[model samples]
Target: MKSTHFLFLLGLLAACNSQPKDKEKETEAKAEQPASHEPTVNCYQYATATDTVRLTLVHVGDNINGMLIYQLKEKDRNVGSINGTMNGDILLADYTFKSEGTQSTRQVAFKKAGNAFIEGYGESAEVNGVEKFKNVDSIVFSSSMKLEEIPCK
Candidate 1:
């Protein structure tokens, strides 16, 4: 029985570790240096999702648009909002805000693409704090949500 249990645990670990080659970077947390100055540019943002994260997108006819909210955690927990265009399940947004004292911008790009599926990556910081968006860089969420359907805008 003990051997069976150990085998099961090992299998579980193996299963969890076995991810596709394209999504290796999604699981790691990202941190950027804090700044305390004004931003030279308006806002910066980026995301690399294809068709995962269905919940974050609202489709509208052939053209889809939605709002992306990035919560700044370190500075003042400030929330940054961006307007994104949706292609199938992928949504893209670029927004910025001030944290401690520095201004930073983040880009939202499509990670995956499909109907009702939305997958992508995005991170941002203000003058004092950093707020990393969840699901933006999750590898598993990218693959499964490719088949999920989201509401049409």
Candidate 2:
């Protein structure tokens, strides 16, 4: 009777261990599957005689992730990554960048026009050490810098 009970306990332990192996295999199979939707990538650039700005945006539904580089004349170049959401024709994001060996974050806004994006500007105040527009609705989207769609390279 004691030997039968010991055998039964051993069988239960084996069953428990085998179940986890099956679950691990199932998890591995799911991990190997490709994503249902691929991210859409778009690049844009605005250039002139003295300054140039390049933007690359990747859209997955309404969420956006992108890289922005500003090479303005007589100014320290700011290279950064932006992650934000697209609300109607407006794109609002927080730009986190490293410039002059220091990292900083600031709020940026843009308006979509045809195949181009116009940078928005407005009164900004420092909030928690991050500069953000006082009122997003009051931002002016008439900046001369208009980033036009360009081929990714």
Please name the candidate that would achieve the greatest TM-score relative to the true structure: 2
Look at candidate 2 and tell me the lDDT of residue 95: 95
lDDT: which candidate is best?
Answer: 2
lDDT of 1 by residue, 20-119 (tens): 4325555332234444444221112322242112134334443333444333224253344454554444455555544566665655555443333344
Candidate 1, backbone clash total: 40
**Which residue window of length 10 is worst by lDDT in model 1?**
39-48
lDDT of each: 0.43, 0.95
- What TM-score should be assigned to candidate 2? 0.75
Residue range 1-153, candidate 2, lDDT tens digits: 999999999999999999999999999999999777679999999999999999999998778999999999999999999999898999999999999999999999989999999999999999999999999999999998999999999
RMSD of 1: 21.7
- Residue ranges of candidate 2 with Cα displaced over 4 Å: 1-35
- Model 1 has an lDDT value of 0.43
